[model samples]
Target chain A: MPQISQLPEFYVSQIFWMLVFFGLTFLVVGRGMVPRVLSTIADRTTRIAEDLAAAEHARTAAEAEAEAWAETEAAQRARAHDLIASAKHTAALATQANLATATARIDAQVSAAQARITAARDASLGEIEWVAADVAQDIAQRVAGLTISADDARAAVKGAFTHG
Target chain B: MHQFQIEKLFGADWAIAGHSIAFTNSALWMALSTLLLIVFVAGGLQRQVVPGRWQMAVEGFTGFIDGMLAANIGPNGKKYVPYIFSLFMFILFANFIGLVPLGLIGLHPFTFTSHFSATGVLSVMTFLIVLIVGFAKHKLHFFSLFVPHGTPALMVVPIFFIELISFLMRPFSLGLRLFVAMMAGHVLLEVLSSFVISGGNAGPLLFAVAGLPSFVLMVGICALEILVSGIQAYVFVLLTCVYLNDAENLH
Candidate 1:
């Protein structure tokens, strides 16, 4: 085969071209092209890494903001509970004050009614005593036909009423 | 048969001192391959943050070679990425370019790797680099690479000679393997296609019977050649890395 033969005529040109082409390929690809490709790759990687870091930072900030919001919400909730408790305490105190005033007014009305009832009972008893005395005086004069003093009748009636 | 014939393109028989120089089809194909690589590299120069498919493919190839270098030669192998990657792309493109059927246009389909001159240059370059690196790094101790780690005094001389021969044979083996594999595949395809053509001339019925199987086999071989093209390129690079490792670590 022609390939097996080292025919210097064919080999010389082949070698010459091989060196020129291969050397050019090496110089162009190894020196010029490869670095460009590598840099592009490196650039892309760096950009990705930067984007990821930025995303991570944004996520951390968002998490911090969320935590702050939660803390504020908790504080507001506690304040609301405190306000409700204070309002409830004031309402209970006001209800107790109103009840005490109503109770005092009712007790005063009950005491006045009791005083009026006692005054009426004493007045009725005095009237009853006078009537009894008069009757007794008249009856005594008629039955015995004796002249008795008005003062004596009165005194006897009084003593009888007192004993009854 | 006609594909292997070298034709001078335009250069005259110029000789300097004792050397002859002429531009040929082999040079044209090599130049074309280099141009393809240049265009390939140039196309990816834009460096998008979000790369398109072509850019991704280029980067993927680079990463593949990077991974190979790292695996075979360790972290220090990163420095040789350019040389190794260049070798890989050149061989890969040469093999693939060879498969293009340009014979219809009466142009030779140049299978550059099939030529020993091309593969020999590549292999010799690699071997030289390995030698230079070994000697530069290890100096005289580089010779000790031929001596086995555990060997009797009597066995040392013979083993050393064997190792030396094997080491010297690296370039020839590397070059021949690629050349043979590529040449064999192409030759088979050529022969089979010729059979189909001649079978058709004999008789339509014979053509149908013989040409059909030949066509089928041709397609199968074509696929195998494609696979072999990639495998041979990978093997060439892999062996270079192994040689580099041997040089670097003296193992």
Candidate 2:
């Protein structure tokens, strides 16, 4: 083993080189390697955070849009429902008014039919009475043929009408 | 290769050596550090949400790294978790590997060997890179990093020069910290083991006497090794983060 005291000039050069090595290694590792690694880590973290925030914003916006759509859809449905009800109500009222007018016309037509029936029955009854009177006058004329005097004939007719 | 200490150049105890190109015991431990980093990180990354044993261990480490960076820097400082975790793993691995007993410089066949041949070009290269990171982040502010803020303009030149000295000293400090820690830990372990082995030839009474203290110390140092492993790694990363913060947000 070469003691520190006995080490020759070559050993001194080795030490000098070692020191030089130290300076170079630290410079490269510290300046080049470490900074690159650290920056990458920072960049990754920042990118992740930014992506999450953007996703969150998009989600919230989508939710708000969905809510607005739902509201509009509901309003449209309500409008359609109101229109159908109004249409139904108007149709029902129109049908009812039509029925009422038809009923009035039918009533007027039935009353006219009844008046015609009554007038026809009274005309038929008058016709039957006239026929009966004619038949009685003919039978009385045949029986009173023997007496030809105007006063007698008139008296016979009156007597016959009274007996019948 | 000629070795000359900086004490001659700078007239001080803290000196620089030039022309030494061989790997030291510290370099061996540092190379071993990669294995630790790989094992821990690969294990951690492969974890499931509901962790297994390996996953739990990795999770514990990851959580610790996260907590440390967050507390010291800011909650967002978790961005530095992988780097900090890797830094911790390397240091911890280096410390543990350093605990292995060695016969001589670069002679041990095990990865724990501190032999000159074991240290590679790659490990030293990495140290330079870390320092550069501190430099790049600070830029002009890096010069000011050594100089405290609020100093008057008249003091700026002297302070700037001092700051430059300190800034230049970072890599050395970092490298030396790992090297010294590894060297010390291994020496202690080796010495204790030698005592245990030598005592085996003595009488049972003598064997038990030397053996007990050596055994006790070995166990104690082993525990201390674990702590040092974690602490050194933490210190490296802490300083790294502080330097980065200074560079990133200069006063």
Candidate 3:
């Protein structure tokens, strides 16, 4: 074959040119471009990783904030509940105090009214005794001409009323 | 045979000393393949965070060679990426471009990879890298590639000689594998096409029986040739990596 026969003549040029081309390829494309491309990919990967990490950080922060908010809200709720309970307790104590004052006033008014009624009855009883004493004197003088003293008659009436 | 002939282009037969400095058809194709490869790789130089189609293609091939080296040569294989990448791409481009039916357009596509001298130089360069690396790292112990790991004490000498011979044959075998595979495919296609022509002149009967089948075979072989071209380039690189394995890992 000419491939074999022609080789000795063709060798130098082929090798020379092959070296030139292959050398250029190795330098320009292989060494230069390949790394550039891979570095870009590596950059993208790191960027994505950073973004994910930032997102995770944000998520954690939000969760912590929510937890704090919940805690504060619970405290606020408890404070409000305490305020309501204390106000209710104060209102109940005030009501009890007012009821005690009203009850004392009513008891005083009722006892004073009873004292007035007793005094009136005692005054009427005194008047009734005097009337009876005068009436008896009149009856005795008009019907049988017997005279009786007011004092005696008064005493007798007193004794009879007292014993009865 | 004429298809395989190296002819001078540009109307001048120039030489430097005894060496022919004239630009030949082979040189033109080599330059063309380099330019094409550069253009292909230039797309990747955009360096976008997200790769485009051309960038992806370039990166895909780079990653493929990288993966192969990583698999074969272990951690230290990274240093040889540029050389391996260049060799693989150059061979792959030559193979694929050679299969282009440019002859139909009255233009011949010379596949330099089909030349033993071209593949020989490349394989020898690869072998040299191994040798240089092996010696640089291991010094005199680079010779241990011949003894292997598990040779019995009695047969060590014979095994060492045999291994040494086989180890030396690596580059030649590598060059021959690619060169023969490519040359044979091209020759087979040329032969069958000639059959188609000869049969046509003989008779319609022969044309129908022989020319048609020959044409069909040529078509089938054309497809196979494409596959073979890719496989051969891969095989060349794979073997280079394996040889490099001995150098880098010393296994």
Which candidate number maximizes TM-score? 1
Best by DockQ: 1
Compute the interface RMSD for candidate 2: 7.6
lDDT score, residue A43, model 3? 86
Docking class of 1: medium
DockQ for each numbered candidate: 0.58, 0.08, 0.51
Q: Is candidate 1 or candidate 2 better by lDDT?
A: 1
lDDT of 1 by residue, B49-115 (tens): 7888888888888888888989988988888888998999999999998998887888778887898
B-chain TM-score, every candidate? 0.96, 0.67, 0.96
DockQ for the candidate 3 complex? Answer: 0.51
lDDT of 1 by residue, A92-151 (tens): 999999999999998999888888888887788777667776777778778887677777
Q: Candidate 2, overall lDDT?
A: 0.58
i-RMS for every candidate: 1.5, 7.6, 1.2
- Using lDDT as the yardstick, the better of models 1 and 3 is 3
Off by over 4 Å in 1: A124-164, B148-155
lDDT of 2 by residue, B85-182 (tens): 55555556655665554435653423222323223332343445545655666565556565687889899889888887876666566656655565
